[model samples]
Target chain A: MSAKGVLVRVSTYAALIVMALATLFPLLWVTSIAFMRAPERFAGTPPLWPDHPTLVNMVNIVHQQRIGYYFLNSLIVAAATTPLSVLVAGLAGYALAQAKFRAHRLVSWIVMFAVLVPNQALVLPLFEMFSAVHLINHYAALILPAAANAVSIVLIQAYARGIPADVLDAARIDGASEWRTFFSVVVPLMAPMLAAVAVLTFVVSWNDFMWPMIAMQKVDMQTLPVALASIDREHYQNIGLMAAGATVAILPMMFVFLASQRYYLRAVSAGSLTD
Target chain B: MARLELQRVSKLLANRQVVLQDIDCTVNDGELISVVGPSGCGKSTLLRCVAGLDKITSGDIRIGGQRVNDLPPQQRNVAMVFQNHALYPHMTVYQNLAFGLRVRRVARAIVDARVRRTAVRLGLEALLGRYPRELSGGQRQRTALGRAMLREPGVFLLDEPLSSLDIPLRAEMRRELSALHTALGTTMVYVTHDQSEALSLGQRVVVLADGQIQQIDTPDGIYKEPSNRFVAGFVGWPPMNFLDGDWLENSGLDAHCIDYGIRPERLLLQPSSSADAFIAGRLERIESFGGEWQVEISRNGSRVIARVAPNPELRRDNELRLWFRREDLYAFDRATGRRLQG
Candidate 1:
């Protein structure tokens, strides 16, 4: 509409594009390094693209580092965590959203506060509890503790609150029980948010290193991030092998985010806009 | 279908402000009752309380002569259509309509038959496969109605069911609902703040203000003989004009009359005369409404409106005398706002 407006619009787009590249450059650089030979990867002047590309690092990680076992372990932990987290969060969210119970507001406030508490604070207590229960080097030590997430509960509660009370009334009037209403009406209506929350929780659980490292003393029980860190430590000068291990750890989450970006965006926007 | 009653009902918020106070009313089996009020008057809260959605702070509600105050919504056999339609966004119209029945473990064949019949009845048959977001406002409303209808509850609770539609669609749905009530012979309690909707759709209208029932009567009786100034002022568009004046002590003036009230359309223009029901005023403005002109008149620092047939004789700044039959006047107690029963 005006010269100044056009100039501002163009600069805004250019700035966003530049910022996006700046954020994504590290991941791209790691992926490029994963494809290079050790000579090119360890060279003083790192090449943007490998002149003599090789699959040796990926090959070595699979055979020597046993990345396959770690991959399976990560998948098991994430698979165990995501659905359990969604289920527990969904029930808690629905109760918070629809049920009229004493101390409801106080409980919701506590959950919101729980979201702010650092996971590191819980690590020591959880470690102590797991050790007392003799769950060290066991997958249950990792899987069971992640069954509930404060962030997912908050997201679901905010989403479920948007559902009109009358819909529940209609369901109840038709002789549907509270449990049935949750399954039939609330669950279906909150599907998009559930998908987004599941993916986010899965990514968090899969990439988690501190808790898994402390719990799983055995090498076979170690998840991808712990396994990747071990590989980096063992092969300190092998940049290509480290890059390959990092790429494996990062690929699944990238795919998950790409596939459900719409739901993730909508869920995030809905959470921010609600009172 | 069953008779319903709200007896000595009251609702106080946690801060102890009464949102609904000492409400009492009853509907006969298969009768439609409309509750009308301004915003924040607890009409929706009252409807929710009746539908078992809101807890009543005190008092009992009865359906079919049985107390339902302690019962949950499912046990109460009441269906509610919400103001915003509240259709499930992910479900098809067919799924939405059948959800309730399926939840009840109704036979699949029966559920299918009822949904089909309701869709046909509400003209939603073709739209059954479409989701809520795919339909227009009117279609969504019809789907909501269809969902409630399929439940076949003892009582129907509609909360401003047509408020979201366009003006023309609202009129169409109003007629449709009135006709459906007659056909189904179901006890319906509809809530709306729109006077016309309350008047046209209700067999009896309950006017609410500040959580209290002001009047309960048939639409005609309430309009013709409002029980108080609040009801008189609250009902009817181009609301009844109020004039502040002392009762005349002359021979023709009645001793019991306090203030005079007249409907806008009933106030006739007349030349200056010694008529018992006459007011002298200056015409200030005229609004033409196709068939009739609404004239605003000022008299002795008081304003009044009169609906008159379009006329070249009426002009702004002209002195005018407004007259009507003596029987058309209402007398009310200025201190208490209660109408002095004629």
Candidate 2:
């Protein structure tokens, strides 16, 4: 290669590496501190690498702190919400993308407006309504409120716009009912978009703190994020224990993102191109 | 198979725009009819209405002598091959072919046998296990055709099925479609925007323009005796030549109309002294299309095209005399654009 080409390539890779390190340094620091022994964690000049490694903090968090219960509660809420939200969004997206209704434009405008509204703004009203129904401390408070995600519906609708309408019409002519067509034909075509939605919704529900804290006031019913915050309030001086708790709360989201990153990237890029 | 009929069918959009206006036609059993029109002329809309995908605002549709205006698409007992060959991308060729039968609750063994037989017929046996994305365009089209053919519906609707294929493949598929129609002996309605396809495929052709039917007749009749100026201009390749009635009257011809039409192939070059020589013009350009030649002539600021056999002696910018027989001419009223009787 020419000297100029080689120089340009080296600089481009150098810039990328610098950006990567800038983004990952905080996470690396947290992980390193989580593994350090208590005496070395808060030394005068903090070490990037631990002098001595230990698993006692994680063990203590799981055994004595009741972290397992909050973990299971988070898992259940996320598991229940993902499929329910995805199904509702998929059906509504298909209707908005393909069906010819008199109020199509009006409905689309409403959905767009809903997407623009902040979820934090709805917490007070939702709390009031759930309290009136006596569901404030129940798991239903977490699952039912997230059933109709406007972002997921709009993402699915954008992805579904690439599918030709004739295919659905052909399915109808082939003796398949509308419900059968959706399940057998449309769902498979939108699998990647659905996967992206599932991952995002799972992460959002798992990492949620404010709403879960407001809804689940009892210590036994609180989710992992809420439980972590409550423990941090009392044990703020225990850096290692707090780091371990943060790592545990973040592990599932990392695994999910890694597992479905391919579909997630594809869905995002396709959505952008169509828009 | 059974005959299909549309009586005074019309469709209006929710915004009160008329999309189809009083469309009337009949398809006999074992007959193939081609609907030809320009874009936005409602040919596809008409097909969708018949397929029960869209509802008509007025009139009735009958299939097998039973009114089916309110019946759902599945109950209409008709199959359609879409223009884009809408095969399920996630399914294999075998699954796509057997989808309709399986949906209808056919026996598993029977479904397998029929799918195998159809795969063989369409030359897709070796590719049965491959998904739609892995197949070529022609294979995808064949899979779509097999999907419809396996149902054995009373009527078939094909909407511009060959529009996506290349020239050579399109001709081959056209012949294959004709042979398939003959073998099945089922009523079919084919929609296309290509004039040549309409002329070559069906026994009868319906020409539409601006959401209205211009003419419905045998292919030969529609070509030779167009009902109006729109069909005359739309159903021909080079289009017919239209001469003003004022010019004809001034040239000492007895023309009692506002417009005169003649097919490009019927305009012949003649000597100036010939008794039948009708008009004189200068040949402005000559384009050779291998076996045939297109000659453009201009006279008194008016232009017309003449299609003739390639002649080595034809020269550009030469004064030419053109003539046509009385029977080859068509006259129309200027204001209404309707055919005037001779």
Candidate 3:
């Protein structure tokens, strides 16, 4: 290769590596702090590597701060929400994309309008609705509201559109009922988009704090993020403990994303490039 | 293995646009009928209606003396091979072949045996584990055919199944489709816009135009005795040539009509001096199709094409003499575009 071409290639790779490291630094620092002792975590000139690494901060948060209970609560809420969200969104999205209904346009317009409206703006009304129903301290309050996410529905619709309509028609003629066709053919074809939606729903539900805090007023009913916030308020000076809480809050989402990263990227790119 | 009949079938879109207007035809037991039409002429719509994929706006469809207008596709026992060969991309060839039986709640052993037999029949046994995307176009087409075959339905509806393939593959598939139909002896309704395929593959060709059945007859009958101007013009390849009826009168030929139709191959390049009727025109262009030639000739203001044996003596812009036997000419009433009975 020419010297100039070689220089350009090297510079491009260097820029990409720098950007990747920059994006990862905050998560790495928090994880490192989560493993450091109290003094090392709060030191003015803290080293990148913890001076004396320890799991005491993690253990203290799990035992003293009741993070384990809140972690379980978050897990329950996310587990309940993800599949429900994917199923509801996938069915709605397929209908929006393929079904020959008269009101499809109106329904699509409503979904587009919903997607444009920020979730934060709905928090007040949602909290009031849950409170009125006496579901304020329940997991249903967290699970139901986010079950049919507009963005996930739209993403799934975009992916489902790529599936040829004739394939579904063939299934129908092949002696499969509408529901059978959807489950056997449509759902399997929509697997990538479903995985992508599942990951997004789990992460959003896991990280959600404001609604969870408002809805789950009982101390024992709080999720991980709400519990972490409560710990921060009581132990503002304990940086190591706070980092431990943050690290724990992020672990499940990281693992979920890593496991389905292939499908997630495929779904996202397919959704964005088409429609 | 059943007689399929359509009685006064018509399909109208939601906006009240008529897509299939009062279609009527029948396919006898073990007979293959080709539904041929131009695009938007509702050939595919008719096929879909028969398959129960699209409900007919008004009509009765019967298979083996049983009315099935309201039955769902699955309950109707009709198998459809789509134009795009809609093989499920996520499934292996084996799974795709077995899917219909599996969905019908057939025993697993039977499903496997049927699928394996179909794979062997279609030469897809080696690719049974491969996904649809991993196969070539011909293999995918075979898989689709195999999927439809495994159902062993009473009637098969194929909508332009070979239209997507290249010329050679299409020819090969066309032969395979004909052989399969003969072996199975099932009532098949093949829909295509290509008249050549319709003429070659079907026992009877149903010609449709503008949502109406122009003619439904044996292939030779449709070719030789087109019921209207549309059928004559649409059925033949270099398309039957039409000349103004007045031209025949002006040339002193006895033609009592508004239009006269002549097939390209019927026009003789050189007429004997004693020939009763002949017209002379300037040759405009000559296209060679290996053994045959498409010769374009202009007389007065109109142009006509003649498919003639390639002539070494013919030159462009030269005056060419063409003759047609009186029996070979078709006279049509221009006012209604209907073929005029002698």
In terms of lDDT, the poorest run of 10 residues in model 3 chain B is B245-254
lDDT of 2 at B175: 92
- Per-candidate iRMSD: 4.1, 4.0, 3.8
Q: Candidate 1, B194: how far from true, in Å?
A: 1.5
Query: Mind giving the per-residue lDDT tens digits that candidate 3 earns over B312-340?
Result: 99999998878877677888887899998
Once fitted onto the true fold, the runs of candidate 1 whose alpha carbons sit more than 4 angstroms away are A1-25, A35-55, A94-100, A158-161, A164-170, A268-275, B246-257, B271-275
Cα lDDT of candidate 2 equals 0.88
Per-candidate DockQ versus the true complex?
0.52, 0.53, 0.56
- The estimated TM-scores of all candidates read 0.90, 0.94, 0.96
Encode model 2's per-residue lDDT on A238-266: one tens digit a residue.
88888888888878889999999998887
> What is candidate 1's CAPRI-style docking category based on DockQ?
medium
Q: What lDDT score goes with residue A183 in model 1?
A: 89
iRMS for model 3? 3.8
- Using lDDT as the measure, what is the rank order of every candidate, best first? 3, 2, 1
User: In candidate 3, what are the lDDT values of residues A1-275, reduced to their tens digit?
Assistant: 99999999999999999999998998999888889887776678456778888999989998899899999999999999999999999999999999989889999999999999987899999988998999999999999998989999898888888888888998998888889999999998888889989998999999998889898999989999899887889998898899999999888988998999999887777642210
Residue pairs whose backbone atoms clash in candidate 1: none
Model 1, range A1-275, lDDT digits (tens) per residue?
89999999999999999999998999899988999987786678578898988899899999999999999999998988889999999999988998889999999999999999999899999999999999988889998989988988998898888877767776776678889888888897787789888998989998898999899989999999998898778888888998998988888888889988988787767642210
TM (chain A), candidate 3? 0.94
